[model samples]
Target: MKSAHQRFAGRYRPPSPKRSPLITPEGAAALKKELENLWRNQRPVITQAVSEAAALGDRSENAEYIYGKKMLREIDSRILYLQRRLDLIKVVDGLPADPNKVYFGAWVTLIDDDDNERHYRIVGADELNPSAGCISIDSPLALALIGKQLDDRVELNDLDRGYDIIAINYVNATST
Candidate 1:
């Protein structure tokens, strides 16, 4: 088991997600809803499951109890994470005046010379879910794409792969 000091002490690095003071009101509401649901619905459900399993006695041999406790702890950890994130976040409640530029919350679509297309949204590192189409603003791809406008191609040298990708298409957030 990790010491309590190990878990809570030391210099804390804030999450690397782009702190945008601008976000769609919808996004903010969604985060709030998730936080609420985790605390209310999921928290109690997992606790109840653990209680029922513990009632079986002999916790040392109780698989259900051990797993249930682990899961409940995981859920609680996630809740704490979300709470901290929500507190640091500056939710952009509306679109910025400069929609033509790439910034936090802007959905960008990039096309390679081969016409292969991929879309990404630059957001905070905490929100970096590739499956959800969100990429961290601190990432290499987003770094390459930032400030680029329509028809302004970006050439990225993937050093390890010894290949360069030529960006042929760019779509700013407003257009997408």
Candidate 2:
């Protein structure tokens, strides 16, 4: 009974862009923790719930059974993604060769035209958290800053203004 557009609408979306294959050591640890939790704690509980709901009879009309099945599928999908991503990711666990220049895992300070200072860390895509001042290595700003020395001007895309690199430091991967 579904319309043609309705069927095609859900099928014709473009594929998502590929993510970078780099991850910080901390990020890798977090992913591993999540996978363990899902496998050890969450999956068993959801399986039990589904079994109990199915035992109540008439699964076709059982809301609990349907919801449990959906939740199980979601968890399984996430677990698979984490497993695959963890295997493919290369963890950056050491300092950059040159601490004076911008690189992966480097904390960078930039001064803008108005003398406003911004602090950011260039991290892997898996570890990029904007609220914590982490920028993905693939970002335009990070891309422009990489291999640049202190006091260098960074041109981010077509922005009329440029930011001057003020400082660069690399923290130990374990501490992050």
Candidate 3:
């Protein structure tokens, strides 16, 4: 007969890929703000709720206690992750030596073959938001744009697409 532990062995999972440690100053600040809110505001409220629920006894059957404990665990996990990531991340601030060339935190404007203009800000993975036109520096498109100057043509062989760099700026602006 197979033992319970042997019968229900955990599934093997591959480790996640390593993310770049680079972040924009804004991104770092946002992360710090989130950590602060979780630690100083949310956690205490949840802790107090859990304490009150525990005082009612019969914790095993108390829904409030169970839910509160789960929330606390989730908050703690996020706090730990933020702390570790913050420790290793490098915040990129200020303009690059050549503001005309694409670099981390640069807002790049590209014109496709169809004459459609697209704007994107190259930022760290933590700050990527497609709707906001922010792309990760480690992304393929950002990789192709890095070190490229205005009016330069970029070809992505893998995607079979090409774009022309219309503008590159260190500041956030819509117009070229």
Candidate 4:
């Protein structure tokens, strides 16, 4: 029953999400809102629905009961996950005072040698998504970018794909 991902360890646990020790005022508020919304709004709604469905009887044939219970379990699981995550969390919502240097939460625009441009927001692992223009702080590119100034150049390499040296053109807070 072990999937390939789990074959090595019986399950895959993504590394713990990375976050800066401090949060921007905005990031902090958002995380708080998220925790509240999940625990308060979502948790109770799912719980009540599951209880009502369970009362309908014929448990084996009850689609509503099955689905509702599953949903409830997911909600409770996420609530527990968030509780643990938040306890370990350090939100970095504020931009570093030195806008010239790349730091956690910096939005950077890079010009690759091939003349292609890419925009990235360096963020904590929990907040990073390629489609959202965010990258994890611990990623190779972000690691190289950190503490670098605007106009600095850096390279990223993969054994199979060669490497890229991009010049940093801009650095700012992505919040705006």
Candidate 5:
């Protein structure tokens, strides 16, 4: 039997669709580093603060104790999520078989009908940073660009917006 709270929680939030399990090597490394920082540094510091605060007086009124516990809970939740994500993800490294055509890790240059040029890299979801022009492979634009050759015109699923692939290059991260 489900409790009322459990029923309400389940009703309010539908389960999300499964995300792609691919991640770039750099993105995987970043996730691992974050997990290490949280476990080795932040968790220990918060645990110590909570213990000290609890020793001072009644924890019911101890603001420091309450806050420290909350911080610890947040950090632990993040650590668990990172661990699960890292376990599920497969890191994609090295260049694609066809460097001239767009694939994962390829930097694509596109020209809109207006002749405005834009550059985007199709990376795994974990590596997406829109400000840096790194787009997720699952994104509509990236999906549209996949396997397309240079000068190939792409019509997106969205209404009427299309782009011409001007260039495709797989820039090795180690290369200048």
Candidate 6:
């Protein structure tokens, strides 16, 4: 007889590819700070509120109590996730040996086909903030940019546009 998964092949979906476990030092630090804040600062306040709400009695009808409990569960879940991720991720602190090529944690400047300039920092998946121009290393754009040199053209297979690497720096220019 076929296995259960084989019988339900149509309904079963394969797991997504695992994300890169590498994280920039700044990203690691930010995760740490967030975990600390949620655990020590936010959790306590919410706990206190929950306690106060509970003392009011009739928790089944208490909105404050319900909301506080939900917030506490969310905070705990995040704290657990952060702890696990922090333990699993490897923090990349220093610059790559070849500064001339694109690599993780590098702030790259690209000129697109339209002559529009775009800057993106290749970082870990956990720290990707598109609005801030921080792209995940596992992203298609970052994957294509990896190992590329200055002035090299990158033709994205999925996108209609191509980009030229105008600049690549390990340090964040805006930070200075």
Mark the regions of model 4 whose C-alpha exceeds 4 Å error after superposition.
Answer: 1-25, 93-97, 159-176
Whose lDDT is greatest here?
6
What digit string (tens of lDDT, one per residue) describes model 6 on residues 1-176? Answer: 99997899889778978989999888999999999999889999999999999999999999999999999999999999999999999998888899999999999999999999999999999999999999999999999999999999999988888999999999875764
TM-score of each: 0.69, 0.88, 0.89, 0.74, 0.88, 0.88
lDDT against the true structure, per candidate, is 0.69, 0.88, 0.92, 0.70, 0.88, 0.94
Worst 10 residues of 3 by lDDT: 167-176
What does the lDDT come to for candidate 4? Answer: 0.70
Query: In terms of TM-score, how similar is model 1 to the real structure?
Result: 0.69
Off by over 4 Å in 1: 1-27, 159-176
Give one digit per residue, the lDDT tens place, for model 2 in 1-176: 98999879968979877778887787889999999999999999999999999999999999999999999999999999999998899998887767787878888889999899988988888788998889998888888888999999987667777899998878753464
Instruction: Give one digit per residue, the lDDT tens place, for model 3 in 79-132.
Output: 999999999999988888888899999988899998999999999999999999
User: Candidate 3 — number of clashing residue pairs?
Assistant: 0
How accurate locally is residue 44 in candidate 6, as Cα lDDT from 0 to 100? Answer: 100
| Candidate 5 C-alpha lDDT tens digits along 49-101 | 99999999999999999999999999999999999999899888987787888
Candidate with the greatest TM-score versus the true structure: 3
Q: Higher-TM-score candidate among 5 and 6? A: 6
Return the number of clashes found in candidate 2.
Answer: 0
lDDT of 6: 0.94
Residue 29 lDDT in model 2? 94
Residue 136 lDDT, candidate 5, scale 0-100 = 92
Candidate 4 structure, TM-score to reference: 0.74
Clashes per candidate, residues 3 or more apart or on different chains: 5, 0, 0, 8, 0, 0
